[model samples]
Target: MTTDPLHILKTVYGYDAFRGRQAEIVDHVIAGNNAFVLMPTGGGKSLCYQIPALCRPGMGLVVSPLIALMADQVAALRQAGVRAAALNSDLPPEERRDLWRAIGEGTLDLLYAAPETLLRSGIIDRLRNIPLSLIAIDEAHCLSQWGHDFRPHYRQLDALVDLFPDTPRMALTATADAPTRGEIVAHLQIGNDDSFIAGFDRPNIRYAVEEKDNPRRQLMRFLQNHENESGIVYCLSKRKTEETAAWLQDQGYNALAYHGGMDKAAREVNQTRFQREEAVVMVATIAFGMGIDKPDVRFVAHIDLPGSIEAYYQETGRAGRDGLPSEALMLYGADDIALRRRFIDESDAPDTRKRMEQQKLDALLGLTETAQCRRQVLLNYFGDACSPCGNCDTCANPPERFDGTVAAQKVLSCIYRTGERFGQAYVIAVLLGDEDERIARFGHDRISTFGIGKEHDQRTWRSILRQLIAHGFIHVDLAGHGGLSIAEAGRRFLREKPVLMLRTPPPAAKGRKGRAARGGVPVSLDQTDSALFNALRDKRIEIAREQNLPPYVIFHDKTLIEMARTRPANRADMAGISGIGEAKLDRYGEAFLAVIAGHQPDAG
Candidate 1:
């Protein structure tokens, strides 16, 4: 029953060294031990379970929750010369039966099934007779009630874990706060002997948060800086997802929208394109991000706030996945806080659950408005000490702030003079002395405060107003009441006694020609083989068109780009490209050799 333990790591896995704690975790798992790993997206979590699967005797039962999770991970494993298979409701009965037969015959080394599969009547009954080696749970936070994402079916996994207690368990998650970590152990009843970890710091990713103005324009500028790099934008609602995607596409990026509303086939197509193509920006709701395996995404930008800090970390963790320097930008406003509170308060959960939900919302708000460095804010949430990452926009392009107590006093005075009963646009109009029709109708142009703020442009004044609201010096009237009201903090400003500082409105976020890399990265492209890569790509496309499948199905554009950049000259070298499947190298791979042999110019 014993096997050489480290062979898989060096041979089939193709990695010479373990990333972070992979070697230690693999040692534990191969010794019939348990582990709880909290690695980030590209921290090599898969290999910890995968190498052990090959080293153990029976099939490794990986209980994943999503259909796409099973399919993507299984595809990647099978491509890596591992015998892996997945069973899910998405497949027809015939294919399901075929997978079962393979499992029964011991032909499968690893198997992926949804948690709901264990609930099927005869399936669990039959599964009891099969020999099980270990159970690995991905995205283990779903089991926690306090977790932002709670799945009822995942909560039921405890019963299943109790039934198979003898099999060693390892729970792996990309992101989990302390509360969720405790829940994972308690829900699974993991033994005290199991390992628990936080993980390594990817110091390459620069984190930044900008107070909201025109968020769309700001995002456009961020994209322009990382021109021709992969990124993602997460929106809270489906409508915003579609609009942002359409807007980016209009600006000439290959952007795609995905949400739960879309048909399954469309989501799959968009996801496949993002994985295989270059410079694609995917705009999606939260539903689209789980289990996507693409590794080189350069940034994750958020237009709206996520429900919790854990969700934000995991979502942004999708970027900088190849150990390259990347960006995580968030544009937040006070409206986002109100929206989150509305969502949580309106949910049908019990009173206790709603109270917990409020704490989560408060945490997100604190993150948005943190006075400290962005990395310091993030690491503190996870119980770690971190220094200021001197590379973010906050550090690189430091804001110039001036004392604004006088200006705040004037704005509040105008609100009072106008009867304190107008929304932002109207208030701004009266202060700026704009004799627009609304101003005349309200007779606000005749007020004493009118024409006083005319020294500043309308946009600049609005940014100041927004910052005031965010700082809690002023508050928006709720319940369809449209005017601004002075909060308790605003009283200090109105009393002409407090010193408040305000940043200048940031630059318009568009039309940057090129953004030189801020820090920590030297080059964008691998220098060794850029030319030969193009020739191989042409051959791939010609063959793909002849075969009638998508070009990526033959070989991803990423693989071709890497091939040219790395200039691999032999079969073994070609196999190292990330997207090259085994069946692909067996076919159409030799054609790439002629190009690599000489730096052939791409065919005209």
Candidate 2:
């Protein structure tokens, strides 16, 4: 029952020091002040509130967005020997009564509930009578309409400020741009000096984008490097998710499909398997990954382009949450770009919102098409900057550039000559002098720009057109079924003839040869250590199965990797490992020490 933060951190969470701005934010809340925290995923955000709650006198009330996330956090806290419980619809009546009894007796340290549950009349009335340590709003960005994932229920949480006038309030989120940040601060009434923005950077993640040429083969190549690892494959449609999962399953992968179209019970089952098993790959649409707390996802692949950079960042941030190496590969094409634009143009949002969405989409396209460092562009979007990170694909293999003034001019003139009423396929066909009946009927066969771009192949022309759209030299006509039209920039390019450099079309896929072809964040263990790591994982899985909990809830892969390398022989040595708190050391130290003692290294 100590109130010292550092003492609590070392003995309770087993961390030697706080990461980044966690200590400052934690101290601010502990001093009975409201603060807004913007830290990246896996940046130890939970500690900013959890530590303060432990140091204060009363129970901490956490507002989370998902039931699964709440349950996982409660389980992890319980493992650390903290009194934590979650209130949700899934809890049985008897269990709910028990939790309420503990609350009445001042035995619970932290309580997690969804925003909807907290706003209920009975729940609010009961909570008002108790002493509150802090009111924490996780995923606070959901309160803003400008955020990628907006929930109407979150907007109602502003009442907490009035209901608990004297208690400290903290709002935390991992993904929020300037506008979204502003909206959150205004709605929550956070003080200007109290806002702390730990920069939005996950340096362990390697970013790579490839043109969609035989997407299945490209995805397969990416998957080869991540064998038997947990990951997510994002698609744009429910049917595509199911198809991709089935295809991966056919190819001997443990893949599952998830989307809004699936039955609720079926979705729950699939999600459970994904959480409990180590190697499950969830092929899902945007519906699958808002509040997933899985810590060891090694990769995230996108078969289609996401709507904006915010969505992409939030989705990819789900990987490598345990701070190990991870990869994010996105397969994009001109068609994906067109489809995304059409979705924006066809939506019923107001003009201002649509324009903002378009701008966001444009920023994402810039990131995808940039010949410079990918990390630079991504960080710059969130008003942060970094030097050329050597981890991204562009830094590993810099794209070759060529003067593309003529190519730009030819594409622009073709769109105009064809009356600006054709999509990329037809425009590229006219450029390459194809013998299609549509081109013949349009009499574009005799156009002056016809066959001018035949020097480049179809893939090359597709690349060129996609860059044009991304750069704002051209615009998509949603009314004309994604026809191309010249923007003012394109008109200026034609009139003024500026020098333009375009990236060379990447070479044809050679298919990854083996593990030797892997790049970006080397694997943590060598051959001998890998065998021991596997053995430790097997032991963890066995224990987790017996306890009916996810293996990560038992111990993260990072902890197991540490054990494998250090070969902790006894309880004292095991307790010195990073994640092994006093409680876990008492609960699991002997078992893990036995694992290390029993392992037999390969002789070869």
Candidate 3:
């Protein structure tokens, strides 16, 4: 067995080198020191602990939060020929017995358990006898009360330090701002000096935020380019998830709905099908995406605004896990913004927590309404400096901004004139001179602000309103039936009449040209190589189905692309590919070699 992390990485996991801080973190762990890692998804955070576990003396204990995540990690590790097992409530009795036997015999290289399961007296007793090389708390942000995915059980994990006094511990998460990061460190008892913060920028993901107008049609248009690709469409409500899933199914697309409201068996089935099949779209609420391990999800679309920047980053991080080009689009309306504000105000959290959450929401809203590069704004939130990425929507079709002091004044005047008691729809109706009975009864049709905004359409005015709310010039009054109310900034803006520059949304694309306008994935392979890649993909899928495993567990698309480009001919040639580990070469080299040599069994 190789003791060198680099050698173990190549011979087992089959990667050439560590990415970013992976090598540093691995060395820290191998030296029997603790670590704290914050790396973006697809940044290979797992290798930091996995490599060290293989090089160290005993099995690595991974504290997983979800059963599905645990199973997925164990499967992937086993496929790489590492001795791994996940002990969870989902395991059959016989399987649990076998896992315990393996643990007692010191036969496993890694063991994954949820926080609740690991804290049990029985499991704790067993772990005390078994030597642990290192303990890795995956998704450590869950321990933070300030984090979006806070798990109560995770708070008890501080006891791990006391129980395993001699073992080095690592805490890791993908989405944590400074406050949340500090909370994670404190809760996990990890040293602050050992923290490794990788850049939060997922450069491969093209960020696009479109003002909502005809949202269903706009979503369909965006999905056109992603046909035959796996993606996720996030909705704010469970009802929306079901409706979107059904509507997409009616449109001849394979779609599934997932949410916490669904039956456990049903949700599990949908998630399983999504993982096992290709090109499946999952329309889901916020309940679906924590600790997901799917690597080939090509896109993630948001039909509504997410609550906070942290939640948005963590959710969008689900796409393009294989380092391939992927896209994320957020379609939000003024209504969505108001609704999110209402939800925040109505939450049972403490005043300080709510204030922090409100700040986070403001940051995300600022990103959506800004004319600057979306990537820069997102990275800046994580304290990472970024240049304008030419791949995002704002970069491809930069929106124009104009002096909107008059528009801002007009919006403020309308709210003031309407008694600040009406919601955005009624307010917009009054602005657009709609002859609604309510507007007439409230005498809003006679107000000086009525019809003054007819120069731009209703959509334009709504965009302006959202920008105002985002900038803190206005706020939603949840107690007043989701009505719009002027904030201190709005009063100051009206009195000061500052020059307000608001973004002018780009005109909607009329045809299939939208994809080209959005800047697509760079093709790395020529036509001939591409065809070979598809053939290799088919073979991998067939093998995956036979083994009852996700295709990526066999080999990621990145690995297959390399194989197609090189066109390896024999065992030696196959072994040279980036993802072909020694174990995989012995098990699959001959089959993949045959496929590359034009002897594919299924290429009739």
Each prediction's TM-score versus the true structure: 0.84, 0.96, 0.95
Per-residue lDDT tens digits of candidate 1, residues 1-604? 2355455665555445676778888888888887787787777787888788788878898888787767767766665567888877778889888988988998888988888886676877777777777888888778788787778888887876667777778888877778888888887877656755745356778777877777887787777677666789999899999999999999988899989999989998898777666568999999876766666678899999887888888888888766667788888875775567567767999989888877766666666655556667677777776667676665666667777777777788887888767777878888788869978887877878988987778877877787677566766765445467777778766776668777776676546444564221213553344344545656765775575443444554456667766778699988777655555566656877776776743432
Compare candidates 1 and 2 on lDDT and give the better one.
Answer: 2
lDDT of 2 by residue, 248-345 (tens): 99999999999999999999899989999988899999989765888998899999999889899999999999998899999898778877878888
Clashing residue pairs in candidate 1 (N, C-alpha, C atoms within 3 angstroms): 529-564, 533-564
C-alpha displacement of 392 in model 1, angstroms? Answer: 1.7
The CA lDDT at 55 in model 2 is: 99
lDDT of 3 by residue, 1-604 (tens): 7899889988997777877889899999999999999999989988888889999998999998889888889999998899999988889999999999998898999999999999999889989999999999999988999888899999999999899989999998899989889988886678878899998999999899988888889898888888778889999999999999999999988999999999999999999889888889999998897757988888999999998888899999999988888889998877787778778788998999889888888898888987889999998998998889998888988889988889888888999999987878888888889888998888888889988888778777877888888788888876668788899989998888877898986676565355442212224566667777877889998999999998888988888888888888788788888888988888788888888889332453
Positional deviation of residue 75's Cα in model 2 after best superposition, in angstroms = 1.1
What is every candidate's alpha-carbon RMSD to the true fold? 4.4, 2.2, 2.6
State each model's CA lDDT, in order: 0.74, 0.90, 0.87
Candidate maximizing lDDT: 2
- Arranged by TM-score with the best first, the candidates are 2, 3, 1
